[model samples]
Target: MVRVGIPRALLFYQYFPMWHAFFRALGAEVVTTPATTRATLAAGAARVVAETCLPVKIYCGHVLDLVGKADVVFVPSLRSLERDAHHCAKLLGLPDLVRAVVPEAPDVLDVDVDLEKGTLAFYRAIYAVGRRFTWNPLRVKRAAAIAWAAHLRYLDWLQRGAGEAEHDSETGWLNDWHRGLTNVAPLPITIAVVGHAYNLFDAYACHDVLRRLASLGVAVRTPTELPASATRAAIARLVGRAYWACEAELIGAAGCFLDDPAVDALVAVIAFGCAPDSVMMDVVQRYARATGKPVLMLPIDEHTGTAGVATRLEAFVDLLTRR
Candidate 1:
């Protein structure tokens, strides 16, 4: 059996189940780089220049970790997931970037996913990737169908407020959210967290911030719980239109939180060096201030200390509780 490695950074958080199902349907054994760690971040940073963003650095680390463990690594270049708007440049050229830095990385199976060309282009790209593993187009199509089903189930899971059920330790809060449906006292504080999914959910990347909030018995709301219509309305009202596809997670979520009476405050997590986020976060902050919502902007980088993030989160929650 051929082992195919998929990094746990970037698109992994967004589309991992689909990726896993598609590859497995093709009969490829799949392995993923474990959760981010100091060592993972260090290995990734060593391969890239200092200017690269932390998420991209961690991606490089994941690819490096897969060097000897897999026959090929799946690294797709996603130019756009929606029309007109596009992904960050780093994500668009990720295959080349990872290959350039992580020279020891195993052979890579890459495909271009540009929805601007049309939604069909997205499906065709996955088919192209499946072809590398097997010649049977029929098998590829079946894999696509199975992958689609998995994607839908994953979305439904997200809507329930529990993140991926796959992890129990670090994401226990994610797994525990359903108990709220059963009947539980609401936490005193309800905070809305807005950021790139990678930065928000990647435990090590954000120093397990959400789990920390959960440990405090705080009820946390995230972009995953938002409705598409609300995000679109927020985009329309905030900036006329979204400059980046992922703005729904940041600007849209923040916009919704500002209007929501239940949410006590807003937290924005952004990685340093992401130009779009820096600019968009500025807009969010200005709007948040005008609306009287206490907002905390946490900037992370390779040198970000765990203690620092913990202290800041504690302080932010403290401020919210006192109000």
Candidate 2:
């Protein structure tokens, strides 16, 4: 059986279940890199050029960790899900970038998806891979369908979990809700965290910052849990200047927290050298200052150390408490 390695960085947070289901159904062994740590960050930083953003550098580090452990490594090339609505250029260039950096890298399977072109484009790409490996297009299609269904189920579960948490928060039963669902104790301070979906959820790459914050009695909220439409409305009212796409959502979430007295502080996590995030961080700081809400900007990269992040977080929390 062939061993397939999946890096626990980037989109792994969003599409992992689908990837796992599809590959495992094809009878391939899957190996995932361990959670991100100082060592992993250092290894990744050492492998990539200094100019590369933190996210991509860390992704390279993850690829390196799985180099000899698998027969193939899956590095997807996502151009745009919608027409003229592309992802960060860094994401579109990941596969080629990794290949360039690690000549001895394992066989890379490039999965390209353009949602603007239509769903069939996606199916065809996967089908091509299926034919290359298993020689059975029918089986591949079936497996893909199964994987898609499983992915939907996982999303539904996340929504349900978030809904329940909100309900508990409303009723002042947050402690019970946190214990029953997440098994983590609630923090005395509530923090609003803003970042890309991948960075927000990838425990390893973000150094498990959410968990660390929770352990220190801090309740963390992401834009996913915040109401998008309302946040957009708030952003327009607060900033006057509208934000675009992910930036809009992030700004909206920050705006919502800034207006609400219950949210004690704001934490904006951005990848080092991310152009969009760089712009967003400036806006977030400007907004925070105007609103008189404490905001911490955390820039993460392949070489980011957890100790530094933890100390900063602790200081931020202390600042919030004092204020």
Candidate 3:
């Protein structure tokens, strides 16, 4: 049986089910890298350029992890998910980056997902990926349908407060989310965490920021929990449209949080040295300052120690709780 490897970093948290379902539907064995760990970070950091963002470094480690385990690794080049929005340059060049960094790894399947070209362009990319498994167009269509359905269902599940789990994988991340939501302590403070899905949900990247906040008796709201209409309404308040796709989401979500009376403050979790995030953080900080709301911007890199992060979180929680 053919095996396809997927890295669990970056966009995997957002679209793992779709990828998993698509491969399984086509009778391909799906293998994924383990959750991010200290060793994983170290290994990835050794090969990545010092200037690259932490997520990219972690992703590189994952790709290398699958070197001998699978016949081909999937690293799609994501240019744009919508007509008006484009991704970070790093994401747009991820496939080539991985190939360059891990030349010894097995074949990598590079698929382009640029919806700016047209809707059909996006489908064609998926079709091309599906063709690697089977030549029959009908089978490919069925796989694509299953993938789309799984993606929709995953989104719905997150909205329903079901928390997120890599479909059919070990349940640690999902369990952590649920435990945070159901904490026994009274959560009198509500904080909106605004960032890309990869940053907000990845435990290692943020050093379990969600659980830390919940333990401090604070309720955390992420962009994934917001309604599309609400996000759109928030985006309309911006002076101009954002160019980067993830930055746009953060901007919209930050606006919503700043405008909401129920939310006590805003926390932006970003990767250190990320140019797009640096720009978005400036926008968020200005809006927050003008509105007289407290916003904490936490930037993490490979060198960030968990102890320092915990101390900052503790201090921030104390300040918010007293306010």
Q: RMSD per prediction, one decimal?
A: 2.9, 5.6, 2.1
Worst 10 residues of 2 by lDDT: 168-177
Model 1, runs deviating above 4 Å: 163-184
TM-score of every model versus the real structure: 0.92, 0.79, 0.94
- Angstrom error at residue 82, model 1: 1.8
Per residue, candidate 1 scores C-alpha lDDT tens digits across 245-309 of 78898888899989889888888889999977988998899889889999988899988898999
Error of 3 at 173 (Å): 4.0
> Cα lDDT for residue 148, model 3?
87
Steric overlap count per candidate: 0, 3, 0
Candidates' lDDT values, in order? 0.83, 0.73, 0.82
TM-score for candidate 3: 0.94
Candidate 1 has what TM-score? 0.92
